[model samples]
Target: MVGAGIGGLCAAAGLQRAGVEVVVLERADEVRSGGSGLSVFSNGIRALDALGVGDAFRAVTTRTEGLRAGQRRPSGAWLSTLPADAVAELRVIDRADLHGLLSDAVTAGTVRTGRRVTSMYPNGLVESVGSGTAGARRAWDRFDLVIGADGLRSAVRTGWPEDPGVAYSGYATWRGITAAPVELRGEAGETWGVECRFGIAPLADGRVYWFGVRTAGIDEPGDPALLRELFGSWHRPIPELIDATDPAAMQYLPIEELSGDLPTFARGRAVLLGDAAHAMTPDLGQGGGMAMEDAATLVGLIAPFAGTECGDAPELLDEALRRYDELRRPRPQRVAARSRMIGRLAHAPGPLLCAARDLVVRATPAAALGRQAAWVHEWLLTR
Candidate 1:
């Protein structure tokens, strides 16, 4: 396994629980400690259950059950309010908490921090650079499989044959967690404007996780004041949420996703998973959900190979991997495409288009919107 993000760690944990030896290679000196927030939808929750970490996740995350969630205008009037019953399974989570849970699930010493995977091959060979040692690279081999769970610019995916590259989504975000909890006024969801957005959701603790997004150049300045300038006057808690954040800890990122779908997620003995395979816009809040589903599905499919006594172990491994690619590819790519389309519509530029978009949003019934979203959130773990 390369990269130790949610997907990679989840795969490692599941693989270990199946009695398979696992190793996780991460470039960072330590498992990344903290992050602002992540949205885990219903499908993601079910994937967690399939992975056996459902309870651990629930203990640390706050369910969005009773919160009035949906789209809103900059003035704070609801364009559409999602039905409470429709969104009952959604959860707002602090990334660090979820990371800690997956990290703990893996067997101790399984993750080799600071061991960066430089390259991998179909023959299950991994070339890595370890900390110190004059940056000496070592080649490790003899594995039946290699999983690339690295993020958007995955080395494994980049090294895959006919790699299609990634594209900028033309929007950027400033994400932060408040130093202290700010009063939410009993609401959680996104506030959308022309070419921009602001989101607010509570963590299990009182601190709130919020983000401000703007359609901007990929290299837009990471100015802490930009958020206030963009959202200070919009709504009551949006400004207050900004004020409660620590300037030094704010995170700025330009959203990007895979440029195009790969012909296959498999190359030789290696497979691509998570953002490494099909990075999509977070407009649907399904990015993390897709990753979790990928991890669970792959782990489940390959479990029988863990201690196979059959002489055709290699054949079984090959079949399972082939099945993984066949079963997993279409859904996520479709989700990514749908998310990209939503991002474009939400960020429609100028007055006329924005007005039309808002009108459509207001006209759409809440239950109808929920029904449209049901397909994305209705997945269960499959073996």
Candidate 2:
């Protein structure tokens, strides 16, 4: 694995459990997640269970169910919500905590930090860079298979001649976790306004994870106070969430996703996974879930090779990878496209369009929204 992000670490855990010797090369000085929070939908929970980290994942977030979540206006009026049964599959977790859980699931010493992959091929030949002055030179390793989970700017994906690269979503977000436990007051979900949205949810540990988003340029001011300025007057706890967050820890991120289409995710003895393969806007909250699903699907396809030597089943591996591409690629692309559309709707350009959107969202039946939620959250991994 060429990256130690969630997708890569999850794959490492499963492969090691299947008796495969895996090495996860991470470019950072250490393995950690940068984001403040993540929404792990039902499919994601199932993926973690398949990857053998489900127990820890659930343990991190004790409140697995019963979150009455839906959209709200600036006045805090409920817009529309899936029925409790539909939303039962949703759980919010601190990204860093989940990262630690997945990291622990992997075998000790499996991830070599500060190692950057310079080049890779379909035949599993890899050239990596080290951190120190003496370690600057390229070092080579050949493996039975290579996986690129290196996020949006993946080196493995970059080497692909067909790669379309990434483009900004014309929006930015500020995410933060409360320094101390804050009372959720039984409130959760997103509050929407013109070009701005505030999402709030409680972590299992009582700390609240919140995110504020607005349609804007990447270089157009991203200060934490921008979140306050944009969302201060929206709602009650929304302001409290922002006030409780330390300014230094808040994250300002510009949303970006893959621009064009890639012919295939499986290329030679190497494959792309997670954001490396399909970097999507976070509008649908499926970015992490899709990555987890990818990990589980890829691992399940190769599970038959457990306890066998690497490269022992080249033709079979090729066939399985083909299937991986066929099975994994379409759903996420569809989801990504859907997310983009939702982002546009959520961040509609003008007040008139925004009003129309709010009216449509309000008039839509909760059950109708529930059905749509099922289409995204009810995914099953076929072995």
TM-score of each candidate structure, all chains considered together: 0.97, 0.96
Q: Report how far residue 217 has shifted in candidate 1, in Å.
A: 0.7
Cα lDDT tens digits for candidate 2, 1-383 = 99999899999998887778899999888888755999888999999898888988887786546676889999989888768877676788888988898888888999998899999987899999887433676799998889999999999999989899999998889988999899877778888899889988788888888989998887887878677678888878888889999898899889999997678998999999999999999988999999999999999998887665456578778888999999999999999999999888899888999999999998999878888889998888886
The TM-score, computed over Cα atoms with residue i paired to residue i, of candidate 1 is: 0.97
Q: Write the per-residue lDDT of candidate 1 for residues 1-383, one digit (tens) a residue.
A: 99999899988988888878898888888887564888888899998888889889988876767889889988989999988876788888888888988999998899888787887777998888876533565757557789999889999999876788989999998888999878887798899987999988888778898889899999778698888788888978898988888898888999999999989988778988899999998888888898899988998988867878689988888888898899889999999999999899889998799999999999998878888789888997666
lDDT of each: 0.87, 0.88
Residue 266 displacement (Å), model 2 = 0.1
Q: Per-residue error at 283 for model 1, in Å?
A: 0.7
lDDT (0-100) at residue 359 of candidate 2? Answer: 94
